[model samples]
Target: MTSTPPTRRREWLAPAGLIALSLVPVLSGAARLTQLSTGATITADNARFFDSPVPIVVHIVGSSVFLVLGALQFAPSLRRRRWHRIAGRVVAPAGLLAALSALWMTIFYEMPASVTGPGLSALRIVLATVMAGAIVAAFLAIRRGDVRTHSAWMTRAYAIGLGAGTQVLTFVPYTLAFGAPGPVLHTVLMAAGWGINLLVAEIVIRRRARAMSARRGRPAPASVVSAPLS
Candidate 1:
């Protein structure tokens, strides 16, 4: 049996759920491409989306790759076989591109379904910055052979990237209950999305650490790389 430094199954479950939830946005994003290819009439928000769609598209594609492939890294068989390292190389850059594109979209393009007032704009900037930093730190830590730190930082970045998935859980209930959310509610809910994911990441991280301690009779490294949940 595997020691619990990172029990693969428990780590796998979280990202599996996240990936499943994220499909909602991924399918919507793909439809945008289909509509573009077929010369469908672009009206309303569709028109705005096309006006500056590159960044959003990049973000969608990049995050899909990052989130899905990153989850696979938690498989003990794959991780032991060194597939985790190979996947991390791709995931790291994809995450960075997603963050950069998100930053660009947040700065220049105005999303119609949501508001980008000063408060929300600032929130986006800060989150994007944190995401970027996390990616860089993960990359650097691995280069130094610090798998523990790399995992933790990668989890942090992945949590932020997974906010799209969490937002469905957080914000959609309101739309179902009432109607479309106003700008304030939208901003508040979106912020909650990132907060919730990060909070989940921390909980998972700590839980794994405790489990590792029990299984190994010693604590996991202070900054062990988190399971691929993020």
Candidate 2:
């Protein structure tokens, strides 16, 4: 029997990992949508979502498409084909939809203060806006034929969009160790989730830049990368 080459196998690892992480939020979003559609029991936590269903529906569906399809874009082999361009057409709009809907929810949703304190709401508004802006920047870059800039911006947007998945990771360990976090701790944990994703995205962007530069026998570009949104 033949086996896949290690180098070939390694190329798929990143996208696979991203898809795995994305599944957490995707599944949770699915459950939320199901609850909304089925008219599940209204609780303090979910009442806001039920009342304002449009934004949440848009956000969930859009993010699901963006995350799943966007992951495939990271696969080098897949990107080498026409599939990448076709997928990007859908992925870009989906990402914008997700980000903009999130911004709407953050601004308009009336959640219990205990669940979503002012600080957390403010953070969401800022991050959601940033995510939307990043997607726009990515689209503009690609239109100008600046592939590197487009990739970097898309990476930043994807990182911010996936913050909810990262939050599950952040909250799981803390919740397991201690009971449910209070407002301050909850805000800190949420920030940590976005912070971690952005830091990793920056590292990936710089590494890719260096690799591309090296391929052309040039020094790596200076790191004047723009800041992450979420």
| Winning candidate number (lDDT) | 2
The weakest ten consecutive residues by lDDT in model 2 span 221-230
What are the per-residue Cα lDDT tens digits for candidate 2 across 175-201? 999989888998899999999999999
Backbone collision tally, model 1: 4
By TM-score, the best candidate is 2
Q: For model 2, what is the C-alpha lDDT against the true structure?
A: 0.88
Stretches > 4 Å off in candidate 2 = 220-230
- Please, what is the whole-model Cα lDDT of each candidate in the order they appear? 0.77, 0.88
Worst 10 residues of 1 by lDDT: 221-230
lDDT of 1 by residue, 1-85 (tens): 8576556557577557767876866786678777866878877666756787677778878877888887777555677776787
- Listing every candidate in turn, what is its Cα RMSD in Å to the true structure after a full C-alpha superposition? 4.7, 1.8
lDDT of 2 at 107: 78
What's the count of clashing pairs in each model shown?
A: 4, 0
Model 1, stretches more than 4 Å misplaced? 1-12, 113-118, 212-230
